[model samples]
Target: MTGESGTTRLPRQRDTTPTAQVRLLVAVGTDKHPFDRLVDWLAQWHAQAADPVRLTVQHGHTPAPGVPGGVPFLGHDALQQAMADADLVVCHGGPATILEARRHGHLPIVVPRDPARGEHVDDHQQLFARRLGAAGLVALCETREALHHALATGLADLSRYAVAADPHAHEARRAAVDRVGQIVEELVDRATRRPPRWRAWARPDRGAKETR
Candidate 1:
C-alpha cells in the first residue's frame, strides 16, 4: 500500500473469526500458523461449548497482530511455564513444547507450519508428529477437520505425570515391554561402540611396520 507521500504502508489482515466462546491456549514459537484457517471453525465450536471459551495466544516472536483476545505480538518470558499451567495447550511441534506437555500430563495438539508455503521452515513438525504419534502420546492433526475435532474434544486427561519409566518395556517385541527393550538395546549399543579414552591409548599401534 502506497502512503500519501508515495511511501509504502503495509495493510494488516485481521482474523475475522468471532470469539464468542472458547477456552483454549495457543502457543506458537516463531512459526506461522498453517492451521490458522481453522480459527473460525474453532471459534464456532467454542461457541457451542457449555462453558465460555477463552483463548490466549502467546506468540514467541514479533509477528503480525492477530484478532482480539490475542496477547502482545512480542515473545513472553513465561511461555513454557504458562503452557504447563494452562488447562489446554495448543502449539507447534517442537521438542521443548512436546516435552513440557508430556511432563505436565496435558494433551497437546501440534500444528505444522510450512515456510516453503509461507507457513514455516522445513516440515519439522511433520517429523515430530510422526515420532510422537507412534508413541501413543500425542494427537497429530494435519487437516482442518481433524483440528476441529481436536478442538471440540479439547484435551484428554490433561492431568497426568510422565516420570520417564519403561511402562511398556517387559518382553515380546509386540508387547509394551518389547519397546522398552528396543530403547535399552539402543542405549547399550551406543555405550559399547565408544570406548573410554584409556582404552584407545591401550590399543597397540598397527600403523608401524610389523617387525618379523
Candidate 2:
C-alpha cells in the first residue's frame, strides 16, 4: 500500500520464512503533533548508510520522506511485536515508550522532543531522556552528528546499553509514584471545597445591585 507521501509499504513474508537481517523499528509515538525532524533524519540516515539496514517506521502525524518499505502507523499489538523482533529500536524520548522498548529487552536510542521547536507540549521528554541517559539506561542524542555516532558505535552492541537492575531504578520509580499520589490527593482536596455562590455579590458597591 502507498503512504500519504507516496511511499510504498513493504509486504511481509509468510510466517514460516526465516529472517536474516538486523531489523530496526523507529517509533515516533502516537502524539497528535508532528515530529518531522526525526522523520527526516531517518530518511537521510537510510539514504546515506554504508551498509544495507532493514528499516521500518511508525510515522505518526509527521511527514516522513518516502522509504522503500515504510508504514505510517502500526497498532499497539503490531508495534509491540515489531519491537520484540527488532535488533535495535529508535524512538522519541517518551518515558512510556522507553520503558516499553526496555520491556522487549532492547535499550532504545532516544531523540528527545523540544517544546521550543514545537515537538511536544513541554520539555519533559528532554528532562527524562537526560536522566535515563545519565543512568546508562538509554542512548540519548540531540543532534544528527550524535545520532550518527550512536548508530555506528552503539547499534553493533545493544547489549551494552541494556538497563541493568539496580537500587537507583527502583528508588526512582517508587519516589515518582509516591510524589504523584501526594499531588493528586492535594488537587482532589482543593477541588472538593465548596465556595459561597453569592460571595461576589456580597459587596454592595463592588458588582452589587444599586438601590432603585
Candidate 3:
C-alpha cells in the first residue's frame, strides 16, 4: 500500500474481530500510579460517545467505583489479545504497547506520562512518545486533554508514527541490532578470566619438589 508521500507501505496484517464486544482497547499507566486517572478520563469520554456506540474502552487497570463508562480491567495477555481484535488502541507511552498495537494494525493513540507532574518515575515516556509519533505508527497525546480528544474522535491517522518496517528505518534498526549482536557474540567468545590463586599451580606438588 502506498501512502500520501508516495512511499510504499508494508502489507497490513488483518485484524480478527472477536465477539465484537470491544472496538477500542486501552493500555494505560507505567511504573507510576496505575492508570487510575486515565481510566476516569476514558469513562467520561465514553459517556459522551454515541452509538454504533463509537468504542468499548477495554482497560488494563481497575477503575474505582462509579466510573460510569469503562468496565473490568484485563490482564496483559488479555489486553494484547483485545488489541488484536480492536480497530483502535489508546495507551500511555510505552514501547511494548506501541509494538503490539502496530503488530495488530490497530491505530494507536499514545498519551505521554509527565514525570514533572509525578506521572512516572522519569521522562523516558516522553521520549517514547516523541519517537513513535515521529515514526508515524501512533498518534501522541501530550496531555489528558489531548488524550480525551484522541479517544473521543477515534484513532488518528498518524502513520507518521511508525516507519515502514519493510525499508525506510529498517537499515537503522537492523544495523543497531547487528552491532549489538556482534558485541554480545564477541563477549561470549572471550576467554574466562582466572583468579590470581588459579594462576598459581593447582598442586604445588605437581612440580617435583625441589630437592633441598
Candidate 4:
C-alpha cells in the first residue's frame, strides 16, 4: 500500500505462522529529552533473555542500547511498518504512540518518562499514562521491575498484548484521547492564570525607592 507520503508501505497483515521467535518493537518517540532509563531496562532484559526474540528499538535522543536493531529515529512509514510487523509493541508514555499502537492492533506496554529523572519537561506523560492505565488501555510500567515483568510476560504470551482493530475499539480510544486533551488544556489554562511565586516577590513595596 502507498502511504500518504507516496512511499510504499508494508502490508498490515501479520505473520500467523507458528514460530518460536517473538517480534518486539520499541519506540521512545521523537522527544528531545533522553529516556535512558527505558533503554537501560530494555538492554538488561535483552541481555539475559532465554527465549528466541527479535527486538527493534527506535531509540530517538537516548543513547543506543547496543542492541542489533537500534535506530536513532524512524520515519512515519517506517514506524507504521514496524508496528504492523511487530507481535508486541513497547513504547513511552506519549499518547500519540499509544494510539498508533492500538490502531495497529497492539495493546502497547507503556513506560512513562520521569521528569525528576530528566526524561521530560513536566509530569504530563505520567498523568496521561496513569489515566489510560486506570481505564485498562495501555499496560503502564513505572519501574524497572515492572517493565522487566511486562517484557517477560509479553514474550511468553504475545496474544495478551494484542488488541482488536475494530471500529468500537477505535472509538473508545478516540474518546480517551479527547479526554486527555481536555485535561492538558485545563492544566495549561490554570498555570497561565496563576502568578508565579517569583513574580509575587518582585512586586514593588509602597515605600520602596523609585527608579530614576
- TM-score winner: 4
Clashing pairs in 3: 135-160, 135-161, 135-162, 136-159, 136-160, 136-161, 136-162, 137-161, 137-162
lDDT per model vs. reference: 0.52, 0.71, 0.58, 0.82
Among these predictions, the greatest lDDT belongs to 4
lDDT of 2 by residue, 1-212 (tens): 45333444343221222444557788989888788888888778778776666788888888765776467788888987887677778899876678767756667899988888899876667766877789888889899887777776644555554443221244555565566456445544564567655543576665655332
| lDDT per residue as tens, model 4, 149-200 | 9989987777778776532344556776797678766654654475544433
Which residues of candidate 2, in runs, are more than 4 Å off? 1-19, 161-212
Which lDDT value does model 4 have at 79?
96
Q: Estimate the TM-score of every prediction.
A: 0.53, 0.67, 0.57, 0.78
Model 2 TM-score, all chains together: 0.67
The RMSD of every model to the true structure, in order and in angstroms, is 17.9, 12.4, 11.5, 6.7
State the displacement of the C-alpha of residue 121, model 4, in Å, after optimal TM-score superposition. Answer: 0.3
What tens-digit string does per-residue lDDT give for candidate 1 at 3-45?
2334443322222245533346666665444444434444555
Worst 10 residues of 3 by lDDT: 157-166
Per-candidate total of colliding backbone pairs? 11, 0, 9, 0
Q: Return the candidate ranking by lDDT, descending.
A: 4, 2, 3, 1
lDDT, residue 149, model 3 = 74
lDDT of 1: 0.52
In model 3, the Cα lDDT at residue 29 comes to 37
